[model samples]
Target: RLAARSGLSVGRLKISVVTTAKYLIPSLLGEFCQAYPNIEPEFQIGNRAEIIQRLKQNLDDLYVFSNPPRELDITTDFLTKNPLVVIAKQGHPLKDKKSILWEELYGERLLMRENGSGTRYAIEAFFKENRIKMQNPITIASNEAIKESVMAGLGIAIISQHALNHMAPGNLIELPVHGFPIPNSWYWVLPKGKHVSNAAMAFREHVTQGLSHKKPNEHA
Candidate 1:
């Protein structure tokens, strides 16, 4: 009953989506827009710094990201927990292995995200903490590009499992690694102590319901 009434109003709501272009650019945003056709979604695809700056300037109504700052004057809600996985070509020698160790990646050519990318930061931190020596053979900015490069046999990379659905058939293979599996949280942030617009609130509820309705028996 509420779902049909939520997005009917044409209140102009401005949303600033922060995060990688992989998830938001088409998938999430496309569905969100379909639910609330009147509300406009603006995206600022960059590192965390850009999103923080936008929030500081009151330029955004909401922030969609993997992580939000601890001290920001924002209300937050947990959205999803995404796990990190290593990826290579399907026929790559590593695919046959049950599991790979951090040390096993040493000297392997890697296609990596640039500095300031959250995924790259998390993976690098994991490697540093475990004292793993990894080779950075190439660096790119977008997940799509990195996935394509890895599929082309340019190098292997660590990426979110959620993004694997977008990769090619028998092209990029996700490798299960022992002592690895970087889990990260995705969140929604809104201004603290301020009333969120009806349109924005509706969008939030729509997304929440959508996620909540995902059945265990269904394929993602």
Candidate 2:
């Protein structure tokens, strides 16, 4: 084990990340792997609760979360901003509206992530602080599914801006709702006092350098 931690080119890297981080982490991991060809990366993707369970068990060398679990004794590093935005299918009536009020969403069908989702938690907190109650929300388990549903014109959803990176140009449009693009960020987490593997450390350094080169808007 000690020998493994001392070498970066030939060891396994176990990384667990939340479902939302799926959009960003894989590409980063791909870059890291390309640079260190022999390093094996075990990437586990799950929703917030599942990832938290893995964190509690200390199951991986690293973990990623948009909203880190508050009760755990873990150390975290900011990876990138994960802004949540409101999106609706193209041609929707509200697409052209400017500075749409939060109240305007009250009548529209809202698509939500399942309970225990970091995005849902953030959105719920925002709604509570604003005294807004979702009239009737459709709970979906994955970000991809929610995006598909939104594109199908089922309803509008609040999702990470990164999720929009690979989307087609006109399938969906971001809503001009006030207080939108809720400010959030992805973090790299590890149990407090945990041993840092060399491969994991290398990946961290790679992410830092990679993100530094990105323009501000490109972060989303």
Candidate 3:
């Protein structure tokens, strides 16, 4: 709860965040809501391009982007380093292996996010750089759909570890991809020269301090 003595907006803080749909749905948003009921957050999950576009339009007080561009006209702060992981159905052929190679995934029926999605871009780049051949993926728009596809043994995918918690037991398995992880940092950005609202600033400080005090395991 916001301190009554603060006399801040204390009722609403419209935070616009751009991160993974997986994180927004069940992890980051949930924790934030539980901690600050007065703060109302609106999220738009998309690729770096979409997030940057929204920032340029002054549509959001804050944006949570992965790998935000250095040349953007915005102020930035680090949130967390998210590592990518490969996901597959349980009892998959590669499950018993300690790790799998990028080449090992060649010819696999991969599930992929739609174009313009940050997750899809990263996965595609990784495969291309390593010359790993993948079959035409069944493209989906949201993380939820992707998760459901993987759970049904439709195809495997590389996604943020945040989604692992929500996977159905004995239905989805995390595949260890070689040369994987491809660590990405979550960042908060604000438009240049624009002063932040009092409520937004309060929530920002709360989140910044909260992140600083977090145990490694909590973020990990």
Which candidate gets the maximum TM-score versus the true structure?
A: 2
Report the C-alpha displacement of residue 51, candidate 1, in angstroms.
1.9
Candidate 1 lDDT over 1-220, as tens digits, reads 2344544567556666545434533454556677667767655666666667777788766676666766877878876665677888878777788888766777678888777677787788788888777775588887788888887878788877666655445577878888766877677777688667677677677766665665532212
**Ranking of models by lDDT:** 2, 1, 3
Against the reference, the lDDT scores of all candidates come to 0.69, 0.84, 0.68
lDDT of 2 by residue, 8-62 (tens): 6577889999988877667666677777888988999988999999999989999
- In candidate 1 the C-alpha lDDT for residue 50 amounts to 67
Name the runs in model 3 displaced over 4 angstroms. Answer: 1-7, 10-12, 19-40, 45-49, 128-135, 167-170, 209-218
Q: Between which residue pairs do clashes occur in model 1?
A: none
Stretches > 4 Å off in candidate 1:
5-9, 21-37, 167-169, 215-220
Candidate topping lDDT: 2
Q: What is the lDDT of residue 177 in candidate 2?
A: 87
Compared with the true structure, model 3 gives a TM-score of 0.80
Whole-model lDDT for model 1 versus the true structure? Answer: 0.69
Model 2 residue 64 distance off true place after TM-score fit, in angstroms: 0.5
